[model samples]
Every structure is written in structure tokens, then in C-alpha cells.
Target: MPTHHIVSAFDEELKYLANRIAAMGGHAERMVDQAVFALVNSDHGLARQVVANDEFLDIGQREIDEKAIVIIARRQPMADDLREIIGAIRISGDLERVGDLGKNIAKRVVAVTEARQPVRLFRGIESLAELALTQLKDVLDTYASRSIDRIGFVRDRDDQIDAMYTSLFRELLTYMMEDPRNITACTHLLFCAKNIERIGDHATNIAETVYYIVTGAQMPAERPKEDKSHKVTAQATAAADPS
Candidate 1:
């Protein structure tokens, strides 16, 4: 093949690899949403389906890796092209981790199904799942569009997931303290929320990777600051504080 043809083929491979990554992300998002839906609705069938679908995510990760290796070996891309190839590898790994997290959440759903009585409603889990889903979608969008602005939004949304996780932990701790009977169910709920929150973090990691690929610069470690405009005053206490 001519040199021009080889470069064109290499570029095409990179494009296809990116599409595969997006497909992987889409599957991961579905896994998470299905896991949460199962937990909240106590749908045994959905939980089982999520467990079975995990294999697809694994297959996707493998495909992306295989294609990347083929490109590296055949094209021998250098510099920025090499970085793009490596970045796809890293992104696929993160997507696999997110898939694992979803599977973990599904396992927790199975545990919840086994436990009879003392099953508290999983409000915290629902909130965390929603936040994670939003972040996951946003990150995938950044990847598709190569938009730096969306990356910042994805990172900012992570704070909401973390706060929900913290709140869930505190609530579960209270449950465990109040009634020893609550310990088993609460512990499982805690683990489920933790898994979902970790998934959100992984999504943020992807967003950071996207930013790096676009600008060749790492995103800062900065976090969103708390809004403190609603300080309670002794005189005429405010009815509420809106974030």
C-alpha cells in the first residue's frame, strides 16, 4: 500500500475505534440504569439480565484493544497519533471498570432480593444512580463531540454523586445504630451506593481523559466550592435555602 493509503487507513481505524468506545459507554450506561431500576423496583428479571449482559461489555473492551494493537503495529503511528491510540486504550479500560461497577450494583440487588423484611427503601441509591447516569451520558457526549466545556460539567456533576453517597452512608449508619435488625439490609445498601458512586468517579475520569486529548493538558484537581449565601441569621430566619 502507498504511504498516503496507509495513513488514511490508520485514520479510519482510529475513527472506528472511537465509535467502539462510544458504543461501550452506551452499554455501560444501560447496565447502570438497569441495575438501579432492578433494585428500586425489585425486578429479579432485570437484575438477572444485567448480570448476563456484562459479557457484552467485556467483549467490547477486547475489540477496542485488538483494533488499537492492529493500528499500532501496521501503521506505526508516532507522536500525537500514538497518543490518540494510547488514549483509546485507557478510555476502554475505564469503561470496563464502569461496567464492573454496574455488575457489582446488580449483585447487591440480588442480595437485597434474598434479604426478607427490614428492607428499607433505597432513596439514596436512586439519587446516586441518577447522578451517575447523567455524568456517564455527559462524558460520552464529550467524547463524541470533543467538547471541552462538557468535560467541566461532567466533573462538576460528580460532586453531586459524592454528596449523595455521603448522605446515604450517614443515613445507613443511623439505621444500623437504631436497630440491630437494620444492619444487614443497610450494609448491603451502603455497598450498592458505594459501587454506583465509584462508577460516577470513573465517568469523571473519562471526561478528564477527553479534555487531555483535546488540549494536551491535564485538567486541574479543582472541585466545586460550597454555596454559603444562605447563612442562618437570628432575626427573621429564612424559610429555606436554595442551592
Candidate 2:
């Protein structure tokens, strides 16, 4: 009887951790959306609000960590319980980083506003955010449901986000090269785009953690990576231009 009671208490503790993680996930997703919206619309007020709201995620993480440590010390969980606690810590950390990424984008709103950029660039950035935020929301749903069916699709979509980011990277470089005056705006947009791409990355990391939580195995080490921005160099572009 006492053993069953202890197990019940442990389960309750795990549930608490899961609930905290879900709250953090939802808050982080909203932050990403608002940050992108602020950047695209040049809404300085909304951007400032996002920068201020990051404290919620930080506080949530600290709370989860503190609870997990107490549970670990008291319960000595094994197998799935251990995975759940560990995964909660990891997921919370990723969500916190997502919040930071969102904050980073918000911080750049003012910088990107210094030079006048075309609407197309902002649209391009918005499209990338849409995809990334979709990935994030889907993965969070998968985590909540523990549905294996949704996991693969979420993981696979990371490549799509990477490809889109690469396309944007190329287009931004072209604009900067075409007009030196656009450099300031395009450069800030580039960093913002990178932050959106990283939000996709954190979503992918959460997908892997979800997989681990549901299954005991780690995901395959080699996931497909399509971001080729590093190879886009002046010399490389010139060499490829066989005029």
C-alpha cells in the first residue's frame, strides 16, 4: 500500500512538471509570433513588450528546475519517470532559449528600422516565421499528446525551414550587393532571420526530447541539414558566375 502511494505521488510530481513545460511552450510560441509581427510591422511598442515579457519564461524554467531537483532527491525515479523529469528540464531549457531568441528578434526591431527596406524582405522574413512557429506549435502539441505519429513530420519540417532561410539569405545578399545603402536594413534582417531559423532548431531539439520521453532511444545522430549560407562567399559567387 505504501509503495503504491509513493508511486502516485511521483506521478503527480511528473504531471506537474509536464504542465509547467506546456505553459512555457505556449508562452514561447506567442513570443516568437509577436516578435516577428513587431519586426514585420515596425511596431516598436509590441517589440518592447516582447522584450519585457521574456521574464516569464525565465521564471518558469527556474521553477521547473527547482521542482525537478526536489523530485529527483525525494523519489529516486527510474526509467520513464527519470526520462520525464530529465526531458522536462531539457525542454524547459530549450523553451527558455526560444524566449531568448524571440527577445533577440525584438531587440533588432529598432536596428532594422534605421534603413528603409522593401516590403518584400519583411514578407520573406514573415514567411519564415510562419513555418518556424508552425513547427514549434506542432512539436509542443506532440509533446503534450505524446503522439508518435506527429513527431516525424515535425522533425522533417526542420529541413524545409532551413531551405527557406538559405533562400532568404541569398536574396538579402543580392539586395545588399545591388545597393550598398540597403546593407544596414538587410544585415539586421539577416540576424532576425537567423533567430527565426534557430527557433526552428529549438523546436527540433524539443521533438528529439519528446521522442526520448516517449521512447527510451535517442534520435539518429545525422539529421538532414540544408542551411548553405556559410558557403555563399564573394569568391564562390564570382566563380559560379560564368559570364
Candidate 3:
């Protein structure tokens, strides 16, 4: 016979943790979207707001972690209960990283606000950001609904973001090569693109965490990567000087 009172208290604690993580996920999604919008529109005010909002996500993650730890110590959960606690901890950490990446993109937007940037560059970045934000929103929805079946779908979509990023990287590099004046803005955009790509990765991490919580199994393996930035860079260097 399980202790009804203790189990009830533990259930409440777990629910609280889940709610906190969901809130953090929401903040992260908004921040990422706002940061990218600021970049595309050169809106420094929005970028600054995104930067400020990241502190809230940091606090949320800490609170979730503390609450999860207390639940573990008090309830001494086992099996499925233990998985739930650990999953919350892992998801919150991923959410925090997502916040940080969004913050990075926001910072870049601020840095490039005064610089002369090409509209095509902004277009490329906007496209990449759109895909990343979609993945983030889908994964968060999946987590909230506790729908494990959608985990693989979200996981598979990350590669699309990676491929988009790789394409943007090459396009930016070509712009820099064509005109040295474009280097400063292109460099900042490159960083912003990388940050957005990383946000997609964090979303994938959360998806895997959800999978673990549901199935009690580690994700099969690292998803096959489609990011070819390094290879493209190497090829560009070799073509520049064949000796």
C-alpha cells in the first residue's frame, strides 16, 4: 500500500516542476522569435528587451532545479517517479541553453544595428530563424502534451535547420569575399545564424529528454548532422590558393 499523503505531495511537486519548465520553454520561444525579428528589422529596442528577458529564464531554470532536487530528497522517488524528476532537471537545463542562445542572437542584433547590412543577408537569416523557431515551438508543445510519438518528428527536423544554416554560412562568406565592407555585418549575422542553429539543437535535446521520460531509454544516438560549415570553409580556403 503506497503512502497516499506522501505520494500526493510528490505528485504536486512534480506538477510544479513541469509547469515551471513549460513557462521557461515559452519564454525561450518568445525570446528567440523576438531576437530574430530584431535582427531582420534592425530593431535595437526589441533586441535589448530580449536580452533583458533572458534573466527571467535563468531564474526559472534555477528554481526548477532546486524544486526538483527537493522533491528527490523528500520523496525518494523510484522508477517512473525518478525519471520524471530527472527529466525536469534535464529539460530545464536545455531551456536555459536555449535562452542563452537567443540572448546571443539578440546581442548580435544590437551589435549590427548601426552597420550597413544587405537585405539579402537579412532574408537568409530570417529563413533560418523561421525553421528554428518552428522546431522549438513544436518540441515545447510536444513536451507539454507528453506526446512521445512526436519526439522523433521534432528530432528529425533539426537537420533541416542545420542544412539551412550551412547554406546561410556559405552565402554570407561569399558576401564577405565579394566586398570587404560587408565583413563586419556579415560576421555578426554569421554568429546570429549559428546561435539560431544552436537553439534548434537545444530543442532537439528537450525532445530527447521527453523521450527518456516516457520510455526510460537514452536517445538512440546523436542525430546525424547536416551542418557542413567546416567543410565549406576548407573548400573555400583550398580554392583560394591551390599551391
Candidate 4:
């Protein structure tokens, strides 16, 4: 019947949209990995590649937005169908932000490479990157599979990434305080660490999107935050006080 054919076509469009989102997620993940690798290895070439690849992510986001709008206009989807299209748009936006964060890291990598830095500092950054990358990969997989059960696991991991970043911030501050020459390198590394932390945040946002797509309900509340960088800054200020 005509209705059956229309339903089939709508399903196909949804599938295509889902596939595009998955592809975007993969690119975002790879960019994060490469940006961190460049930072750890001082590979300016790899950093440049990450910066260049951001254009593709931008294009991907635009394409997804276009497709979502067209589908909504033509299909007039309701409830779950509407959720699916909306989720794609939201996820693509988050992935675009992920790309931008990776680009920020790449920019920092270029700066750090120009200045000499200690190897141990890189080790801390690399460890945080690994955890953040894992979160991103797992959340993308959850989105593709529509696995609501796995969403909680991905959401919980953001705190760990924040904790790691806070620790790195403190350590970098100490390094700068101990050696005047280390200020430039440590400042750049601090920014890179913050970018990685933000990527974890975007991954968490994607996880929430997955939950909404599956259940058609908002997440219960905001996830608990563990970032303590502000506290560390306050401690530093107190220590510097002459009074």
C-alpha cells in the first residue's frame, strides 16, 4: 500500500542519518587520538594533520543538520521518529565540538613542540588522554548500538577524566613555580589538558543524547562533577599571599 511504502522510505532515511552520525563519531575519535599522540610525541606534522581534518568534521555537521531538517519537513515525524532525527542533530553538534577541542589540542601541541618540556609532564597528559579517548569510543559504540544500559557507564567515567585533569593542573602549576623557564611549556600543556577534559564532557553529552533517543525522556539530573582545578587555583593564591 502507499502507507507501507512511505513508512519504508522513512525508515531508510533514518538509517542513513544514523550511519552518517556513526561516521562522524569515528572521525571525531580519531582526531582526539591523533591530537593527543602529537602532543605526547612532539610531532608537529601529526598536529597539523589534525588541524586540517577539522574542516571535514565541520562539513559533516552541516550535512547532518541539513538531512535532519529535510527529514523533519517531509516526514512530520512524531514521538520516537522525531527523537531519532533530533538525536542525530544533537550528536553531530557534539561531535563538531569534539573536533574543535581536538583542534585546540593540536594548536597547543605546536606551541609545546617549539619549547622544551619535561617528559614526565607529557606522561600525565598522555594518561588523561587515554581515559578520555576510551570514554569517547565507548559512548560512540553505545550510540550506534542504541544500548541504553551502557549509557550509565559512559556517564560515570567523566568524573574520572575530570579528576585526572585537576591533578594535572596542580602538577603543571608546581612545575611552573619551580622553574621560571618551564612557564611557557607548562601553560601550553595546561590548555591541552583542559581540552581533553572538555572532550570528555562532549562524550558525556552524547551519552545523554543516546539515552534520550532510546527512552524519549531526559536524563534524571546533571551528572556529578569532580573537577577541582578552581580549588587548586585558590590554594595557589592563598600560598602567594604575604599577609
Candidate 5:
């Protein structure tokens, strides 16, 4: 099929937008990592730095959004070009939200540190965050390649992130119930867990955008029931474990 010049130009713009969004995703992921690092190590300076870097992420998101708008207005793209432009706009919005969520987590880190209190951030939350980051990267790769297979891969990983969230939440609830003194700290930790959960959701949203761009069909939320069952079982196990 011969490529139309308009499609070609739109492709260039969309590619630029994709690259920009991926850059934003990368930065947001780093921000989350730094925030957690700050929490685990009580590094208030690093938490502040993460919060500061979020401003740059905002600028990056705005630039991508403006470019997407320009492409839509000037190019008058249709079909796939249209999908690509719209997807860029939506994905960038999600990425911006991810940055905001990271900032929120960083703010919590500062509060926890200033109180001279320690929150036991276990392997479960760390594992979940890492899983979400992997899914974010996979979504970016699939967006760049427009590969349906890669999109599927991201979907599968999203399930894993969800499971991690379920386990983390259950464990935190146990801590709160065990000690009244743990209430305030556990609440903050819950918010942090929710922030990480939102990041996973945004990554899933980006994957859906890629799917729509490639197929022009909205991907249905099809999380497996088996996964949910397994997550429930694990939560029960965590509740029962005395260690």
C-alpha cells in the first residue's frame, strides 16, 4: 500500500508524541522509585528531589499535549492518524496523573521522615511497584512498535500488579488491626499503596490506548477470575501467617 503524505506526516507527529509520552513515563517511574527509596532509607533530600523533578515531568507532558493538538488541527488526520493523535493526548494525560501520584507519595515520604517514624515497606509493595514499572515500559514499547502481541504481554503483567496490590493491602490492614498506634502510619502507607495501584492502572490505560490505535477497538477489561481467586487465597495466607 502506497503511503499518503498526510498519513506519513501524521505518523511522524504521532511518533514524536509517542516518544515524548514514553519519556514522561520513564521519568514518572523513576520518581516513584526515588520516592520509595527515600521512604525506605529516610532520605528526605531524595524525596524533595523527586517532588522537584515532577515539575519537569509536567512540562514534558504539556509539550506533548500541545504537539498532539497541533497535529490534530493542522493535519486533519483520519482513521489511524486520528486514533494515534487521540491516544497521544489520553496517554499523556495519564502519564501526567502518574507524575502527580508520585509527587503525592514523595510528600508522604517527607511526612513520615519528619515524624522520625518508620514504616515497614515490605517486599510486596516493592514487588508491585517494580511490576507496574515493567508494565509501563512494555506499554511504551508496544506503542512504539504498534504490536498487538506486546499489548497482550502488558495486559498479563497488569494482572500481576493487581495481585501485588491485593496482598499489600491485606498485610497493611493486619498491621493496623494489631496495634492502635499503627493506625496513622498504616493510613499513610495505604495511600502510598493506592498511589502505586493508580500507576498500574494508568499503565493499563496506556496499553489499552495502544490496542485501540492498532485495532481501532477498545480493549475490554478482561482480568482473569483465576487471578483474583489466587489473590484472595494469598491474602488469606498472609492473614494467617504469624511471622
Candidate 6:
């Protein structure tokens, strides 16, 4: 076999892997979008559809896994080539988890819809999901572009998603505390919000994967994270208020 022909085959295989990952990324992002829309709108059917679409991501991950294993065995890829293929698998795992998180939120739509809560709370969740989804798209774009230039920015925005989720957490707790009737719905919303936050985390994971594939170096020891929901308490919030 001609050396150039072998190199061409290798390049084509890598391209196929990247294209598949990009397709999965878009599908996962859409699932989250539709899931959040359904939750906010109380659209049970769309929520169900989002749940159903999760299987596509699952299948995509499996296909990528098989294709990557074949490529590794056939090509005996090393160094940078190995990293690219391995990175795709890692990103696929993250994307699959993101899809699972979206499905989890979708499953709660019925429960959240049953418990009456303020419209503003749902709006807050929608806003947070939007931010996370945008960042997810950005990180996926970085992966497809094969550029590390935008990865740092995408990674930094994960903090903003955390802060937004934390803010929504406090607001939901305040509503639940103010009215016992709101607890059921607010609790479900809290879970949904956490899922969105986790999606942001997955986006960051993809960004890190992109950085590693491009630069062959791990990100710094500590990445910015601002989620404070676990530490928050109504009593502390009230005590800290000077107004």
C-alpha cells in the first residue's frame, strides 16, 4: 500500500469520528433545549419526545465507541492521532451524560407541572438553561473548529452558569419556605436547575478535552467554579441581608 494512501485513509477516519461527535453534540444540545422548553411550558408531550430522543445520543456514543476501537486497532494511532481519537470518546461520554441529565429533567416535567409555582421561577430556569446551552454550543464549536483559542472563554463561562443556578436555588428555597404548597414544585425545579448546572459542567469537560487534544496539556489544577447552593441557607441569607 502506498504511504500516502494509508495517511489518507487515516485522515478520513478521523474526520468521520469528528463529524459524528459534532452531530451528537448538536443532538444533545437540542434535547436539553426541548426538555427545558417542555418543563417551562408544561408541555408533557415534548418532554416525552425529549426522553425518547435520548436514545439517539446513547446509540451515537456506542457507535463512536466501536468506531474508535476499530480505528485504534487498525491504525495503531500514536501520540497526537491517539489523543484525537481518545478525546472523541471522552467527549462522547460527556455528551451522553448531558443527554441523560436532560432526560432526567424531562421526566420531572409532569411532577413540576402539577405543583403550582410562580411563573418567574420557571423563567429563571429557562434563562439558566439558555446560558448553559450557549456555552455547550460554544465548546462543541471549539471542538469542531479544532481550535483552542475559544476554549478558555467557554470554560470560564461555566462559573456564570453555576452562579445563575445558585441564585435560582435560593429563590426557589425562598418560595418553598414562604409557602408549603410550593415545596413540591420548587424541589423539582431545584433538581432541574442542578441538571442544567451539570450540563454546564459537561460543557467544561468538553472544553478541557479540546484543550488537551490541541495542546497536549491539561488545564490548570483549579478551574473556576461558583456553585454555592450546597452552602446556602434561608437563615444565613436573611441574617446577611442589611436592607
Please give the CA lDDT of all the candidate structures.
Answer: 0.77, 0.88, 0.83, 0.86, 0.75, 0.88
Candidate 5 lDDT trough over 10 residues, lowest sum: 225-234
- In lDDT terms, how accurate is model 2? 0.88
The sequence of per-residue lDDT tens digits that candidate 5 reaches over residues 10-88 is 6666667777877887898788888877776778889889999999788987898789888878988888878877888
TM-score of 6: 0.92
Q: List the residue pairs that clash in candidate 2.
A: none
Give the per-residue lDDT of model 4 (tens digit) for 10-103: 8888888898888888899999999999988989999999999999889999998998999999989898888888999999999999999999
When 1 and 3 are scored with lDDT, the better candidate is 3
Question: lDDT at 235 for candidate 2?
Answer: 45
C-alpha TM-scores of all predictions: 0.85, 0.92, 0.92, 0.93, 0.83, 0.92
Flag regions of model 3 displaced more than 4 Å.
Answer: 1-6, 234-243
Mark the regions of model 6 whose C-alpha exceeds 4 Å error after superposition. 1-5, 236-243
Worst 10 residues of 1 by lDDT: 225-234
Instruction: Pick the winner on TM-score between candidates 1 and 4.
Output: 4
| 104 Cα displacement, candidate 6 (Å) | 0.8
Candidate 1: where are CA atoms >4 Å away? 1-6, 115-120, 223-243
Colliding residue pairs in candidate 1: none
- Residue 13 CA displacement from its true place in model 5, Å: 3.2
Backbone steric clashes in candidate 4, count: 0
lDDT of 6 at 151: 68
Model 3, range 6-114, lDDT digits (tens) per residue? 4576767778888898899899999999999988888999999999999999999899889988888887888878888899899889989999999998888866777
Residue-wise lDDT of candidate 6 within 116-180, one digit each (tens)? Answer: 55689799999999999999989988887776776667756888898898899889888988888
